[model samples]
Target: MSNAPITEIDIAAFTADPYPDLARMRAAAPITYVPQLGATLLTRRDDIHVQEKRTDVFSSEQPDGLMTLLMGENMMRKDGVAHLAERRILFPAVSPRTVQEHWKPVFETAANRVLDRLAPRGGCDLVTDYAMPVSAEALKAITGLVRMTPAEMDGASQAMIDGCANYAGNADVTRRCHAATALIDHHIDLMLSDPPPRSALAVQMQGGLAMTSIRANIKLVISGGQNEPRDAIAGTIWALLSHPEQLELIRQGMASYADAFAEYARWVSPIGMSPRRVARRDTVGGVTFEPGDRVFLMFGSAGRDEAHFQAADRFDIRRDTQAAISFGAGPHFCAGAAASRCLIAEIALPLAFRRLKNLRLAGDAPFSGWAFRGPTSVPVAWSL
Candidate 1:
């Protein structure tokens, strides 16, 4: 430990583009101490796999204040058998087939509308024009935020995204947190207003749930309903553009696009890195660590590790990415993974292929954050 270089993990460089430093760290020391965040960075598959499992030792405190707001009492931050019960309720919200069936019409409507508008022009920005809308609409539908003006939804979603993903320190984070909460609160009000006969929120509210449970569940569904779509949409658009030949193959019915989309999620690996604490003492990879020492489980790097994947550098969507960490792992795995996947299929796939053909990459797409990976602005010219 004394001989180890005190590497500084710059969240800024991570937010800008992290591949270079991630590769460097993975190559040199898969598990190394980083001074910047005052934490040990684990970027290797083995290292990350172990750290993520040690829920008692590492903890899921959500050090970023803005992130905590989006994930207040969210699943990953809690551990042990108790969280399992909360997940039972969350199960209905993210059931893959249920989500697919739930959002199919909504997604089709949104995608068709966007495609109709953009296809005539022959080309459009996938993020702003296509990806953003379908995801937003689907999320709005999920939160029961019906008939909200596009501008209001956009403003609310962008504020939440900024609050969760962008950090300017504690004070700024707190302010943005309130903004995000206000947005979600507005969404909750909409749900309570409509009540939708026997909808999810209706049942919960009718049950007269405790203020704590109500707030927690509301935040969970709405925040996920909001953010997951943006990442899925933006990330899928970037992937489709990057892999046009694959996209073309899929269009020709020569490929199973569902698996491709799943693999793409793994290859792109969004949500940055998440840490878990060890509830019991544990030893991993021959390294003994005491309880309460935070070990960073770098999912972004783990997806690219040689041990888990062959030719990990390639962005091939055809790869068999088995239960990839892009969604996270163990008991704390993402509850919204199914909805996210469904959203990609219904909205992202349709919008990308239907409206934009001949989708060629422009230049180096702008993006940031190793943990939360997606193109900031992926410029591409397209035609029908």
Candidate 2:
């Protein structure tokens, strides 16, 4: 009968691994209020979709009181014309045809290359070796980045990750955020300074787009690209381990398994929640929030809403999912979604199956901190 969310529920751990809490929220109210956070948490599939789709009513911008202090705004905060223009510049990489033509090769090349180096030796940190690189490579080639170095890309990305995972609204976080933004900004400037022929980024620069715009867009693209793959790859491997039957099912059905990555995406729902701003005067779950109330889209909880899916908590690679909002819905959905999935399909998932045998969760699972969930590090092994 209580409409309150379990506020003491370790949100960090939920971000680390949320299925357990998601179960509680779904059953309690489907749309419950977290009194501590001052925003109502909507967990049911219908409510989430309804809220996310109402772009005009629930603005993409968050109620920036405390959030802007932690995660700085980029495209995730934009709406209307600003959002469309930014997305258009980055959308080509994830376009249906571009995904088919460009991403598959990027994945194959990166996966095969990393595996070739690591497979003969037995095992390597999939997060560092295979998972992140596939995404990094695809993003670089797709973006036409002139400065092609994983170290540079990783540095820029890792700064943000560390910043996010350790976001305490303190001096350290401030340093990391500035440092990360600077590295990415400087790097993008160099590339724009010396435009190259046939480079994806160069193409954008020549498209009459401003470097200020490009800097923000590419920073977002690379940072997001880096963050999702680590957890997603880790989550995919985690799912395969927990559900060996499903893993084998995927192995036998390699062709159909190509799309299994998408299911894993929906099931894993890597980026735990998205922040939004309430459009105008409105009410939710009997709680009246003003024109600019900040709300966090509980995508993770919605994924496990029983009213939405059968055995909602299970990580079935074979689930009959009809486009879960893991990539979000409405206008502000992830522009690089297809590219992200392509990295997994063409790269991470395949190498994982080919090189690693009988992958199992290593010891106690380490929960990732901050807004994203999925173990911080997943350790698994196999016979060489």
Candidate 3:
């Protein structure tokens, strides 16, 4: 909050290159309303943590906003007991044990299978060629969906994720998202007809959940599970490529990949912002807010908040991330965090570094999309 009036910036440019603007905002005004987007942006780490813990004050039950626009009115948009119950019902599928035991192998096999084809190429766009396929395959196995080519998964997942990304609800994005969502709907139907043994879909079917609720939750999983890891892995690689010393430290076993991944999540958080509704009139950080106001929890900015993190703008794998809210905090913490971590540490990053010996960037890689941020294209070359 600041004594000065709120300031507005172009959404498109800010999303494309948000770090500098985010730094300035955090310093000048931790909490401010963006007239251009009609949402209040919360950037400070402590402020966000306080707001997140108070679900009663800042609700997730946003109906006509981005959360519903992408995945329908699922648990993501529900607050209080309704959200708790839905999340509980959906919990077993992504539980740490379940993901580690069941989905880990799928991710490992997929990562190897992908690199098997791309490693020989000497150079490629890791975003499309590796990260997207590995993430999509893991989601397919977890959901018990029928086998799909990497390209198909990439296309479908990207369309739906893009729908989530273009949160302003552009007509083109909505249409594309709907078309991709149809594919996911079809898979849900197939799973309902004959649930896969021991899969998350099977758990839902056995639980006797309603078809509508099941579909909504399934789409939520598809949207989150499919997209988050893809962007995170790509972002991690891009971060490593940019910081070769840190990359070398990890490669030499001086630093663990898990630590590197955690730092990556903090430094270049893939899901830049999460939406919440101002549930009731509240005052925080000297700023007053009314009920029904829109709140964009700027997780990305929190990662770089100088008050919480030293050398916040620098990418340091050695930094402690006990306070990192990249997987979020409080009740709405991402259920898929463990799986995403396992994928990146055990499968994705290790393979990229080991198999693609002497891996180096092929060209400039820029990141975009404020809603779901990551390197747009990560081109790399390895020793032939």
Candidate 4:
């Protein structure tokens, strides 16, 4: 007997409100391919985790040559020995210790700088004005890129991210992505000519890392370091604002703000899905897959999987969120997860809430993007 024909779901609707359909898929066909995307969508936490751990079967280093086009030759596109070598070179700068000792102060300083401007307005677009600037400046400090400002980095980062979101072959997205890549490459070139006094790139050079590897990995960090924290900070604030009871818990000292950030990572999960490839024929979740298949580890759906989380749809700051896949798992776990957390939990969120006292949502703001989902513009108002 042949496998059932692949099903098709509305891509636009899925991007807008994925929860309803994701819920259906999670309940029924948690591991089946959709003809439209030509990939198996794994929505359940267990299935996603299973695929993520077995880099042997579901390789990041796919023979199909798709990621190479999108992400270039970075650590995300490597596997096994090659992946490890790249990780080792990049790890020193983003390690948990480094985040605590070096980047935390940078994050706090950047957060305060953005807050200084935002606090005076008494109202601002949290995503653009506050979160994006804070993330951009923090990344600037971390990467030590001398030529570009946070605004430039933010635009480039958004384009790269938007390209991934529109990976299904949109002409405008592809054009924007290529243009952003060229701009960032130029910035990288400028940085090389006039190296920063002390940055991660300099450390990589001093450590004898290859120039090509340095460029690719630096771009990866630039993409991630700017994007993830911006979304995380915005999502965390939105979650708190939407659930005032939970917000009250923090104000009343009943719950820690750090736990709220952790909960946001689980509940909303700034970046939803990470893609992997079927390196060799493998069977998972009662389905057999041939080589060269695309499997998307749906972290957004998994974060809300009923089996894994109690009242999964509800946003609760007190929920046990240590198991969330916001930063992913296995060999591909986010290298900058520590810094992202430090920036949100310790620096950005705390300062924003304190400075924007009695901050309330101006109105309902809708978040977009299936690949990376968070508030596009968090219209927030508060007393000066």
lDDT of each candidate versus the true structure: 0.64, 0.66, 0.81, 0.80
Which portions of model 1 show Cα errors greater than 4 Å? 1-5, 61-71, 147-170, 197-200, 206-209, 277-282, 286-291, 360-364
Model 4 pairs whose backbones collide? none
Tens-digit lDDT string for candidate 1 (137-253): 766666556656555666565555555544344566557667766766666775675665323465556655554565556565655555456666766667766767777777787
What ranges in model 3 sit over 4 Å off?
1-4, 165-167
- Which scores better on TM-score, 2 or 4? 4
Backbone-clash count (model 3)? 0
Per-residue lDDT, model 3, residue 78, is 82
Question: Tell me, what's the RMSD of every candidate?
Answer: 3.4, 3.4, 2.0, 2.0
lDDT of candidate 3 over 153-217, digit per residue (tens): 66777787777666576899888888877887887776677776656677777777777777777
> What tens digits encode model 4's per-residue C-alpha lDDT throughout 290-335?
7777778889998999997999989999888877887887889998
For residues 108-187, write the lDDT of model 2, one tens digit per residue. Answer: 87777877776676555656666667667766776666465776676677667556444245677658766877876666
lDDT of 3 at 93: 80
* Clashes per candidate, residues 3 or more apart or on different chains: 16, 4, 0, 0
Better of 1 and 4 by lDDT: 4
